[model samples]
Target: MSDKRRAFESPADLARPITQPVLRRPAATTMGAVLVVLRVLAGVWWLLALTFSWNDVLLDDLGLGDEPDFQALGNDVKEAISSGILNTVLIVGGIVLVIELLFALLVFRGVNWARVVVMVFATLSIIGSFVGWWLGGQEITVHTTLVTLALDILVLLALSSQGARAYARRPRERRARGSVA
Candidate 1:
């Protein structure tokens, strides 16, 4: 018989292994829990700012309070404040509240990027607070300043903990394993 080899192909050649990546939840750590609490506090801070302080600061302090030019507009000024200006302030405040809650949840989930983001924001807040106190000569009570600074420092420390770092890397580790043969 003439030596001829037909194309050797099996059904296995057509079938490919489908790799489904498994999702692993990192072990919960004390540092992570502390971060969660801090994040929740941050969210609450925003909630209070929006619900209580926004109107007072926007309408009374910064708005038409002592503006002589606004006095000429009179009734129109009242109408504008009642309609567009107040609505815009409320809208902006609501957006800030939403962002605060979302970031807090992300940080609580041990997202490394979220941790960095929150730390950067906290640092900025601290700087802004100090600058406002110094430059604006705003009379901020020692207790209020100290409490805010303490919360920010604690959040920074908790996010920098060894356990938090490991927890953040777990997703990357899973991805690495899934990519290998």
Candidate 2:
């Protein structure tokens, strides 16, 4: 067979095992494993926030009392929830959680896109978290937000490393070749 045709051989014919050194060095594996743990924890927090908020809004039904405007906003939110606005919130929150989980899984797989995606998402979340903490007027939330922001910054920095950048770029390279007519 010609060399070009040999390259396109059936899977059965190409089944010979070829030993290769591990691509990820020990340090990279250790660092990546730590990042995966952090990513999973963050993902869980966001996922739980969605469900927790949904449950609180659904069961407690605190529209006015929870608002800064007290009675007026509370009454308005209550009315809105009663009128199905709460459903919209739940739907949106669910979508966000699902996307978060998808990113988490990708991070677990050491996918480069997950790093960029999660970094952007985490940054936005840090802003939202701070805003929510401030608006919440709760000391505990403020503390939590600070810790979360710190962790997110670390994750972004780690994902910006040479190894992470390479992982993310591999797919782009494949696409570039695939796109050539």
TM-scores for all candidates: the values are 0.61, 0.48
Alpha carbon lDDT of residue 152, candidate 2? 66
lDDT tens string, model 1, 1-108? Answer: 666633553556423332432244333334544554555565556556655665466558677656777667768666666567656765776676567667667766
Candidate 2 lDDT by residue in tens digits, 33-144: 4654665566467656755575465446555445555445565666665547556665676676566666656765566557677778767866776777689764534325
Global lDDT of each candidate: 0.60, 0.57
Give the top-scoring candidate (lDDT).
1
**What overall lDDT, based on C-alpha atoms, would model 2 receive against the true structure?**
0.57
> In candidate 1, where is summed lDDT lowest over 10 consecutive residues?
13-22
lDDT score, candidate 1, position 108: 62
Model 1 CA deviation exceeding 4 Å by range:
1-60, 142-148, 171-181
Error of 2 at 139 (Å): 5.3
Q: What is the lDDT of candidate 1?
A: 0.60
